[model samples]
Target chain A: MEKNNNHDRFFRELLSDSSREMPFSDFEDEVMAEIRMEYEKKFSGRRNIRLSWLFFILGMLSGIATVFVMSFYSANQPFAFISDNLLPVGIVFICLTIILFAEKLVKISFRRDNH
Target chain B: MDELYIKKVLDGDIDAFRYFVHQYKDKAYNLAFSVLKNEFDARDAVQEAYIIAFRKLGKFRGRSKFSTWFFRIVINEALKSSKKAGKEKYIADTRTESVDPGHVEINDIVSRDQQKYYIDLAMQNIPSKEALALTLFYIEEYSVEEIREITGWTESNTKVLLHRARKSMYHELNVLLSTEKKTLY
Candidate 1:
């Protein structure tokens, strides 16, 4: 208790205007303005990071379109000559391939909740 | 109203530059003064921060609070100034306050002015990062997380720096005050 009291008293006195000086006035505005200016000077050198978002969206859109086109093509395929005696098996295989690929695509793209 | 004027500047209202200076110049100046400890250096650092902030205002997406973003700029500017000039310290200006031990009542001797001077003196002697952390934490009363965010340091790093700074100040002041009392007796 005594130790804590002394520590508190010490800070109260240390920050006392009698011993320590307030550095300067209106510190926020003056220094912040200067920093703003410096940021401006450096602006021309580097591009902002948000620009990458456009590329990310575009990539996602392209992948989605490709999957849709592939699925549609598979759905329309005639199984007469190719499937022969194993038509049901061939259709099932195609469906399973698309399902597996879709899972893979989503997993590889966003990478969310991998655990 | 000031924020609106600043918005105008961001919108390319060149004349609003005057109000920009009015709004933030002194605040920036004082912060730099506290960090750099040299009046002229502080003045230049603040001026530099203003110019940088003004030029970069357009790119500000308002994701963070304006004051927080502005402080980031001010801190960078101060650090740069310190690096270049190596921090010229202790300007005993007109406001020089020498707290004689006699001023405070005897009952709270530890909290008295003279003891505080010893603490302050110890603080002044530490590395800049430790001093900066102490000031930002205790004087500014910022939370540890806030200090980490503002200083761009990890939470552990902030805690360690603050702990070390406080410990050093404790030891330094204890020795100083003991010697002071010895002389007096």
Candidate 2:
């Protein structure tokens, strides 16, 4: 028991008296650089989502404006013909818009999971 | 002071985290070095731990001191680094490094350095968990309660590990000294 106590004291004193200085001088800088990279990654993911939404909205607006102009200019064409062609185009536009929004949602969820 | 840095970090100022890294780097590195036993591996572990802490900064609830929380991360990272590095063979190698203390006289200059080297070697011979507990206890002067908080071990378990560590350390030193004695005789 006495030997054990002595050993403990000796080791404790040795360890406690050892220098506690950091070996790497640039540790802080490396960590901060990593944090900055993470921030940039998150920011870029958000920006991609925003840009996708912006493009989707713009496409939908332009599609609507084209339909309105075609309706006004093509008064001589049969209303049924116009509806048959323009109806599929409008539906496709709406589906594309919904798909774009869903893609954005999926991307955001994936980014969240990765982080 | 850490709280101030945390708040600023949350406020989107990345530079504020520099203060926290500066404050805890040495202790973090020490704990990692004690566990990993290789300076290069320890540095890598500390770097990885700091990044982990930074990414998870928002989850810190301030119930414990930031240093305590951060140290826990450092310990985990160091353990992972050790495992990945296959450090068991390194420990065995240290044990086999035949020290003929019999040939050399212990003097003021040599005893201090020799004792330090032997103690470190003895620590590596023990289980890593116990060595970690001992490091925190002796080097950091942490209480059993603080060790429990950092290691996530139960209070009784912490005490048991500490007890076992001291015993193992004593046995290791005896074995080393006995070898030297044999050489002398």
Candidate 3:
């Protein structure tokens, strides 16, 4: 038992002596750079989502404004084709907006869950 | 303290992660070296591990100490590197052999100047798992339970590995010293 203890102590001392110092001085910096890159990628993804939403909102508002303005035009006006198809056009626009919004929301929620 | 830094990193404070990198780098390097046995490979493994930890930091549930979790990543990365370099077969072959210690005197053979060199050589000769077990048990002074936690091994398996590791380490040291003795005389 005593011999085993001595051997254990000796091995411990030897192992401690063999413990090495890291050679690379810039190790932390290298790791941090990679981490920063990942952070930037995530930040850019979020920015892209925000930009998409901004464009979507702008497009939706412009569609509504165009329809509203066309409503005041006579049937013989140059935009009569648009006014004649306004209701169906509005329905299709609303459905498409809802689908795009739902897709964006799903993607954001999926990313959040992954993180 | 680690939790605080983890929270800061998760909160998008990228600089806060430097604290962890500085704190664990050396110890993590040593652990990586124990498995890979090459300075450059060990360093690359540790760097990769740190990047992995950072990328996966959000999934950290704080169930274990940050060091334990990080060390596990370091070991896995080192093991993967060793496997890629075709060194895993060499490490695996060393584990099954039992060496007879004979009558070698460790203290008489190892001089102060050569102590670190011979010990490192012996560690390199042993199986990587045994080397890792010895480093965590002796150098790091972690309990068997803690080792089990870090390694995801069962309690009995951890104990058995430690026992075999100690025996293999002593045998390897004896062989190294005996070779040195023959070379000297």
Candidate 4:
């Protein structure tokens, strides 16, 4: 048992002494550069998604407001046509929103799984 | 301290990751070298590991030390490179060659000032897995449980690997020293 302990201690000393530092002086810089590129790539992807959602929400809000205004001002000849088609327009808008939302959700889940 | 850096990195301070790189680089390189046994391959493995750790930094839940998680990445990256290079066969072949002190080459032993060179050469003769176990247990001073955690190996498996590693290291060092003595005479 003592002999085994001695051997272990000896090996430990030798191994510890043999421990080496990374020889590359710029190793940290190289790794950090790669990491920075990856970070930018990931964040840029997220930013693009956010921007797309912003545009989609803005477009949806404007479409709804236009429909609401036209329905209220139905007495005008130009909006009378819109007022008659308001139900179909609302349904189409709702469907589009749902489809876009579902698409975004699927994309997000796929991204999460990939990561 | 590591937590602080992790938080900084998570907060989008990309430069904060440099702290981890500087801190763990040497040890990670040593571990990589132990597994791959080729300096360039080990370096590439370490770089790839760091890149992976950075990409997955957001997923770090802090259940363990960052070093532990990072070391696991390093080991996995090294193992992957080792597999790709088909160095598993190299390790197995070395394992089958008996350590014959009589056949020890005088040119293989270095002067006292180059003891580390001699030790590294000795390490090259052992199985990579055994070398990795020895490096984690002896050089890094990690406990067997920590090793198991880092390596995802069972406790008994880690213990057995450490035992075999020590035996191989001892025999290899004996052969080296015997060669040195023969040269002296």
Best by DockQ: 3
Q: Which of candidates 2 and 3 is the stronger one according to lDDT?
A: 3
Assess each prediction's global lDDT (C-alpha) against the native.
Answer: 0.59, 0.75, 0.80, 0.81
Q: In terms of lDDT, which candidate is stronger, 1 or 4? A: 4
Task: Rank all candidate structures by their lDDT, best first, as comma-separated numbers.
Answer: 4, 3, 2, 1
Order the numbered candidates by TM-score, best leading.
Answer: 3, 2, 4, 1
Comparison by TM-score, 2 against 3, better one? 3
RMSD of each: 12.7, 5.4, 4.0, 5.2
Q: Which stretches in model 2 have alpha-carbon errors above 4 Å?
A: A1-11, A18-20, A59-100, A103-115, B88-110
- Candidate 1 lDDT, B113-160, residue by residue in tens: 555565556666655666666666666556787776677889999878
lDDT of 4 by residue, A1-115 (tens): 7756765666666666778799999899899989988888887777777777777677777877866766678888866776687756785876688688858855874585233
Worst 10 residues of 3 chain B by lDDT: B89-98
| Candidate number with greatest TM-score | 3
DockQ of each: 0.06, 0.42, 0.54, 0.49
| Shift of residue B68 alpha carbon in model 2, Å | 1.1
| Quality of model 2 by C-alpha lDDT | 0.75
Q: Chain A only: TM-score of every candidate? A: 0.30, 0.54, 0.58, 0.55
Interface RMSD of each: 9.0, 3.1, 1.9, 2.3
Off by over 4 Å in 4: A51-101, A113-115, B90-110, B174-185
TM for every model, in the order presented, reads: 0.53, 0.76, 0.78, 0.75
lDDT of 1 by residue, A1-115 (tens): 6754454455444544422232556544554555455546444322322334455556556655655555555555563343344544645665676567556555544443211
